[model samples]
Target chain A: MKNLTIPEEELMLPGHTACLGCGATLAMRYALKALGKNTIVTIPACCWAVIPGVYPARTLEVPLLYTAFEVTGAAISGIKNALEATGNDDINVLGFAGDGGTADIGIQSLSGAVERGENVFYIMYDNEAYMNTGVQRSSSTPKGAWTTTTQVGKVRDWKKEKKKNMVEIMVAHNIPYAATASIAFPEDLIKKLEKGKNIKGPKFYHIYATCPTGWRISPSKTVEIARLAVESKVFPLYEVDHGVYNITYMPKKNVSVKEYMLPQGRFRHLTEDEIKEIQSEVDKDWNLLLEKEKWTQSLNKVQ
Target chain B: MKKMLTGNYASAYGAKVSKVKVVSAYPITPQTTIVEKIAEFIANGEFDGKYIRVESEHSAMASCIAAENTGVRTFTATSSHGLALMHEMLHWASGARLPIVMSVVNRSLGPPWSIWSDQQDTISQRDTGWMQIYTENNQEVLDSIIMAYRIAENEIVMLPAMVIEDAFILSHTMEPVDIPDQADVDEFLPDYNPKFKLDVSEPMGFGSLIMPEGPFMEFKYKGHESMNNALKIIDETDILFKKKFGRSYGGTVETYKLDNAKYALVMMGSTASTGKEVVDKMRDEGYEVGLLRIRSFRPFPKDKLRNYLSNMKSIGVFDRSYTFGYGGAVFSEVRNTMYGKNIPIKGYIGGLGGRDVTMNLIEKIFLDVVNMSEKGQDKDYEWVGLNGDKRWSQ
Candidate 1:
């Protein structure tokens, strides 16, 4: 018998309204397995706001609070402080927000919470764009991607800007722990959450959650596409501990960025030249992460 | 015990005596001292609660809403633009039925930047479903906080409340206030033990998405019912607070020598103090005038306004905040309450942006109402002390 790495208890019930093979749903399921039942989750205006089945029929086994679209950080801070005030500091306060809720409209509140060193876990589930509002372009949307707002017409109106670096933004706040994980790697994702539980201050996780409907990919290919994202170095799996970076998973086999972009229909209109441009950007980012890991490790040794 | 406390300190003492478990707030002028005094209390070990120093007023209200959801009482204070920033979460707090109480120091909203006393800040938030109490002096500012929590936390009327004090008239002015003992306040307003909270043992989702076919409108209808329930509960709580502390605020509407007057003045906030003084001087001169002060602006004492103003020959409503396209916010509501009545009700817009509503202005308003009644003339409203000639003389 093989040793099971994931917990068996399912805090997210089976009857949620998530679409078939929604990567954000699986990301939540694995996060709950790591956080356990003693956690209170605060969700803002994101897909999970509606995914947590309608009133009188909730999906999460742990207590959940739905707040306004941009107040997830403040809400979680309130929940944690209130719990401490009541002499019950053992309960974990978790803020689960979508990328649009984190990197765009919610950035100020998230930055404030991290700067205050709030004792909470903030998870930014990156579906790349506003999937709940029908695939509008968000600041987290990658370049050369087609969205409702960033249309691919004759003039090529796809998103032209790079995706916002949320993990680096969290790191700049000097948070205790900040990591990037994906739905494809449940073990690495769960390990980061469990490690964050033992830390005393704010811990942030930027999870690459794929959107099958928005990306125009087959529903069953959600996790596979997410795995290709990491393998192509488009979304690396790494964690920063006290300003020191460590890449948790490196691709054993070289995978081109074209392999990750070819399957998703959002990038179908991109020309070879545009894909090459994105590929070079991804390589540059991956090399920078490697240098950060090496340079910060040396700094730690000198200390 | 007696203490010369500013309205801001009174707000802090109110929260302290109520044993509020959480204090989350940001600083804005006039309202800054309230949170500063609370921070001072926390620093001196006098207040045994957690003060979450939020970065902005939107976060302040957001934090208070979530803190209250954890089944603990929470307090926050803001003024002017800070309150404007919190407008969205004010609705969120009441919609979730969190029963959070906030101190709103009423100040003028700015385009030209004025941080003075006016009802515009709290008046603009009248429809946010927060029960707003416009306090006249420092004592009522403190007392209303205790009563507001009791009314808002009632089982049938779960809502948020705002204890409003005029920017500098009350917020910065010091007056003797009776600070209640903690033991007595604990008896008057017990611990907030909500039936449903974010508890791990008994997990449940709050404010989840409801489809059109679900009870979405029903939830809003329930909010209306709860607000209606709050009216009666507010009166009951005021009476109970009086029994415990030996003072009462005359329930939604407070009247002064209004029984036998042919013409009367209707107003709110600190301007009503000047109105009372004007009423006394006019009565001595045999003008048959009195005063009516509106304390609670939401659950707006409609029946009480009708009951008090129906017999008067004419009425004057003094509003510090204008309703743009209309005469005055309170005047519109008061006129609507007196529908089909033949009384010549006139609105007087005055004392805006912290300009003083002096005894002369109040007397002038009274005489104008009296002259309009004598001639059976009706005008919608007039702006007092405009200084139009000096500002725009060609």
Candidate 2:
């Protein structure tokens, strides 16, 4: 069995401004562990833009460059290349942004960076909506979920579209490493981040972070809800290395998607038939992911 | 070396001699060959710069923004829809005070998708806080780009600049351009050393949010002050460049035979060349008319224009673009500038959608200027040549 121990370094200083039980906070905490003090994080306008407090009181131990809302990807590429030009090529340049920034406004620049094969790490902390701006629906927001933009009201509501497949999109770029992680699985997340550190090209991480305020869940259930998210297979943990898929953690016993949704007030209006329908969709996607891993492993064996 | 080259190639040569450190590019009509030449320069090891192949013009400008923030010289080029898409990032470039230089080939915007010459493409971006300058010839295009860097990167004036040339008229048409040697260019333009940047050890944040009544207004004031100072620096650089290279375009507004003439024709871009040809022909015919060409639009050169216009009895402002319900873009500006004066100033709108602004048409416009001056009758506005369509005349 592999050792699943995480690093003890706390690059995220305490006395910061993140909300209680914010999974994005934990996501940054662990991401800093993977990329240590020798890292520079370039962030777009999102929740993290304000989480570090105002100037003279910023909580980040490492340097942070806050850029325009849709420019984190292009900013990282420019930063990395400028560092290379200046003879400081050994540091890691990480791009951190939210789902709205990653999946919608920022995808063009992100596509440009990966297409150019820039040496940088892009992390999309997916809380599933535009949480910082009062919980609006984003492209990464799951279908049938209630948001400010997709409100559950008479004559309309709830996100009709499915969540955007960001990991698959990164994998389509033929990037060296693309992974899906969760705040529930820190050891697995850290392990994948460590694996990505050894890779030389562009790496992407789509981390499933739960927004208690956005999801209308209890603050105390942040970790528990995230764990249920994985066990329910709604948020699978996997990595693709050069088109080879690897399911990092396979749940021993699958939980019902209902168990995952019943506690969150965001989905309180979901009917029984609606829950069963979402269950079928989750199962179908999980089976497809399993087949991808199986087929990729078989191809590796053949080669 | 002196070589006959299109205006696009001249733009690329200007960037090469300026020792640009990073070039982010997206291909668009007329501007495509400019980026292609820069790429070829990079591939041939003649130029040492990072060539970023962006997906769209937005990323191209975004990449240049960050690259310039890192204390290095950056450049890019686009036209038409590509430039329209970069509108958002163009404000960011100037608001953050990154002195990025971009070449805007003046192509008409689409609906009918015509890739022809029109000044409206650049005129639409007039309020974006970028220093806009129009070039008359291939040589002036090359020189203005270098001058753009010198003026933009000046400590007092840290803003982005746009060098615009008419599409196909200059971009595709070849003319003799004197490409200066590296040593002369090196002596002229020094290395860019920014005062602040994204440094890990130093740890400074850029583009932070401030409240409405906060430092926002003051920051805007500083940018405005810097822009107002560009006019003086432009004059200084023009004198210096002339001393070194034997070519000088008399600061922002270039005048020809306005010494004792009572009537003058005013315009910008390559159209000024056509206008100047007719002015000289009239001078040889003893018509006593002069030409005044505006090189810089952002600074507007009100004082220089006022000094000259204060002398002329009648002036005709020529604009290739109209602003709908209002007068022509340049004509409106000139009229507003000459508002307090009682001179008979008429506006002639012509040469749109790549329509020919023929020598005969220019001669006729000047002839009308002479006739209008004699009767002291000034028509507020008129479309010069539109295939003589009489429906609008009614």
Candidate 3:
């Protein structure tokens, strides 16, 4: 166990409007600690858009720009340019979007900014589905997740597609920094973000945010469920720097995907066969990542 | 310190002189060279800025938008398909009111795709709240960018500006352009000082959602008024630019021998250069023909357009892009400008899909306008350079 001391200065204060034990709220709290006060955040149409509260009474301590669901990348980029034009280069320009906003609707602009290597940090809090619009299936929704759009019944239909690998897509642009972090692992999440601050060019952090309300789970189990996701290898914590891959946190005892899926009501309808299939898929992805890490290591040695 | 360059180089020079702190861009034809030159400048240490090699046109716009919001003088360039991909963000940049300057090399849209000279792509984005300025030549391309920053960063008009030039014709074609000295440009256009910006010390909300009919309308109305107010600033700044750089193109509207001329041709972008040549040749042939070059599109120059065309006996509008089913895009706008007026206006839809609008085509347009006015007849929106077999079979 690592000794992690949390920062004292809280940029995101309590008593603001957010669901109890909201993973995104906690994500914001930790993200703000790494970003500090010298940051301006642009948020698009997502749960965070509403969670920030209405004008005259907002929660976020940083300057926030709420843009349309599809234009967060463009808006944040504009803000970043405006900041630089005025000779203020120290402030961090952060874009906070949800899975739906980042992986689906905003993907074009996101890819554009990343390819351009815009000096900005984008944090996408993935709750798997479009939770703000009533748990519709987003591209980030993993296979076999039960959402309103991908319901389970006599039809036996669940999300059939795998979650879009946004980190890889970002890395394909040859972005300087990209990492996957989770709300359950605050220490790891904070460390990755702190490390990201030093890297130039576009930095993307994909945070696995748990949604108790949408997931139909107890609020108390949110963090536990998030941790189980990492431990089960469903959502591995990893970082990619200039195409070099490294797994940030390797789980000690590899837990079955069933153990992680069984606790969540979202995946409750999955049969044993389906669970096994998911486990195999996770193993395949893990092996692929391991190969990439090894290949990067060899390249570094040659260099 | 001084070099004769093309309009594209002038724009790059202007960005360099502005000491642009960041540049994020993607490659598209015509516009590709501008970014390529900048990349070279950055690599060679000719320009001091962080040049981001973005993945797509969307990201290029996003990166510049983000950089601009951070109070940096950021620059980017794109054209045609790239601009279409950036359509969604075009509105975002304007609505957010970030004064990010972008150079759009006007190229014909794809699918029967051709990368040639035309004003269709930029003209299509007229309603995106961006202050659009069309250039007749390379000099205007360079000067318009420097002027764009002034108009965009103005307290009233805190919207992004697009400096548009015809692809290949102006973007690729080389013409002598006086590259302004950095010190002269600095004295002419001071450092950008944003009225409102993203700052951590004084946290403020930006681009926040507004109820459809409430503050949204207020903000939109303000944007409209700002664009309207920009017309005067455009002229004022052009005057200042000339005083500083010793060059000017009569601001938003440039008239080529229009005084006492009974017939006139109106257009924008690089095609205006061809129109000017035609007008001169017609004058040499002892015909009373003139040319009106529309420099500003967003602040559409309605009054100036009306004032110039209202007195002319016959006015011909040459459009490079069609509005599909309707007449030419610019022709429609030109007609709309003269809706309640007594002037005889004829619309000629021509040079689409990057077709060349040569001096001979301009002469044909002028003749058509003259015949239409004399015969009191309106030809049902015709396409130039189409023979009987090539004309629509329908």
Candidate 4:
């Protein structure tokens, strides 16, 4: 028998209301499988809020707590602390929020929880835009993405700002474990979550979730696009463990940014010159991450 | 044991005795000391609970809701701006049917920035499905918290509660409070064991989305029914607490000298203390005046209020918070309660923004109600104790 890397248990059932090929739904499935049934997930107002069927019917097998849009961090902290108070400290408290809820409105509460060193997992599923609210521009929306609020029209006013680095934000709080994962790699995503489940204190994961409807791509292309994001270095797969950085995976072949951006309609309007600029920016960021890993490892060796 | 404790410390000690398992709070003026004292108790190993020093009041209330959802007693405290910030979660707590208790140190809201006593902070949250109890002194502040948990955690009344203390007047003022014994409190107010909770062994979803055809309205109606059901529970808890500790702040509404009185003065919170003294003075002078203090505001005690004010020729409802377009918040509700009683209920707006509700002001209100009972109807309401040239006497 082959060694199974991913768990077989179906914690997130099939009757969800997620859009076809929704990467966020798959991310949740992998997360629940990794954390097992002894988990309580507190979801803020996001795609998952509706994905789990309305009252009387639910998709996740684990206990779920739905909180207000900006209060996921606080809710998880409360649950974890209360569980500890009751002498039942083995259960996992998970906070799952979308990009808009995390990178913008919920940042203060999330930062507070991380700084307080609450024992929980805060996973932010990034779909680039506010997919649940119909592709409105969020802080996590990448540069030059054509969201509803950031239209690529007569004046070429796409998203002018760069994507917010959520993992970096968690790392800035000096969290015990902070990592970036993609829906395409379930084994890697599940591994990080299972590892974080053992370590005490706050662990944050920034998962790349593709939205076919919001990005104007085919429903079947969700995992493919997510793979492209990681392979082309638009979103790197790396973990920062207590100031020590380790890149989890490196692409076997050098994939260009043009290959990643060409598929989705959100970035189809990017001119040749704009594509070149994005390529250079991605290369620069990847190199900075490399230097950080090398320098931190050298410092660790000396100590 | 009797201890000289501020209302804030009284609140902390109340939670300590109640054996609250989780306390999440933020630091706001007049409310900071309550959590600070709780922190001290936790540091000294006096209180066995988990304290989350949250970043903001919104998070504080949110954490309280989550903790209570896990089927444990939870508490929090905040003043004006912090209470306002926690407005959304206040509704969330009650809507989720989590019996979370909080101490709201009532202070005036800003735009003018005052940190003094007023009912506006808690008054604004009247419709948020929370059982609000106004306390007169440090003793009531402590006792109400212990009572609030019992009443709120009742099987029929699964609602959150606010034990409101006037900022500076009660929150900062020191008074001798008899702290109940831990064994006595444990017997009186039992541990919170929720019927349904967020548990790993019993997996269920809470606060999920309900479609329009679903039970959203039904859930809200259940909350309303639970609030009305809490009136009986509040009285029962008060009686039980009195049996255990030999102290009780007359359930819902406390009355003084209302028997065979021609006119009545209505009030809430600390101002009622002044009203009590004024009632005594008027009684000695052979004036037919009495004082009716509303202890529970959310479950308005409508029937009890109407029963007390039925025989009075006229009634004066004093409010520290106004409704802007109309009279006071309590005045409107009192009038609604006595809709066709033919009693001339006049509104007296006073003590706003920490302006003192002095004995003279209470005397003025009683005199006005008495004078109005004899003379014909005049203005429906007037702002008492204003600092302008012309006084309310005119």
lDDT of 1 by residue, B1-394 (tens): 9999999999999999889999999999989899999999999999989999888999999999999998899999999899999999999998999899999999999988998988889899988989988888899999999999999999998999999899889899999999998889889998999999999999988999888986988888898899888878888888888888999987688899899998989999988887888888888899899899999888788888889899999998889998788799988888889988888998988788988788887888888889888887657887787777332111
Instruction: Give lDDT for model 2.
Output: 0.88
Q: If you assessed candidate 3 against the hidden native complex, which CAPRI class would it receive?
A: acceptable
DockQ of 3: 0.47
In order of listing, the candidates' clash counts read 0, 0, 44, 0
Task: Give the distance in Å from residue A100's predicted Cα in candidate 4 to where it truly belongs.
Answer: 1.1
- Residues B7-38, candidate 4: write the lDDT tens digits: 99999999999999999999999898998999
User: What's each prediction's TM-score?
Assistant: 0.98, 0.95, 0.88, 0.99
When 3 and 4 are scored with TM-score, the better candidate is: 4
Question: Candidate 1, TM-score vs. the true structure?
Answer: 0.98
Among all candidates shown, the one with the greatest DockQ: 4
Q: Per-residue lDDT for A172-253 in model 3, tens only? A: 8888989999999988898888888898888999999999988888899999999999998899999998788989899887
Question: lDDT of all the models against the reference?
Answer: 0.91, 0.88, 0.82, 0.92
DockQ of all predictions against the true structure, Cα-based: 0.88, 0.53, 0.47, 0.90
Q: Taking the tens digit of each residue's C-alpha lDDT, what string does model 4 give over A97-175?
A: 9999999999989999999999999999999888888999999999989999999889999997899999888988999
Residue-wise C-alpha lDDT for candidate 1, range A179-257, written one tens digit per residue:
9999999999999999999999999999999999999999989989999999999999999999999999989779999
DockQ of prediction 1 = 0.88
Question: In candidate 1, which residue pairs clash?
Answer: none
Tens digits of per-residue lDDT, candidate 3, B1-394, equal 4466666777787688777788888898878778878987988989877776766787677667766666677788999999998887788788878888999988888777788867778888988988888888887888888888887887877889999887777777777777777888888878876766667777877665455557778888888888898888888889998888888887778888888888888888888888888888888998888899888878888888888888788888877787777778677787899888766776777777777677777887887776766787566466776546233211
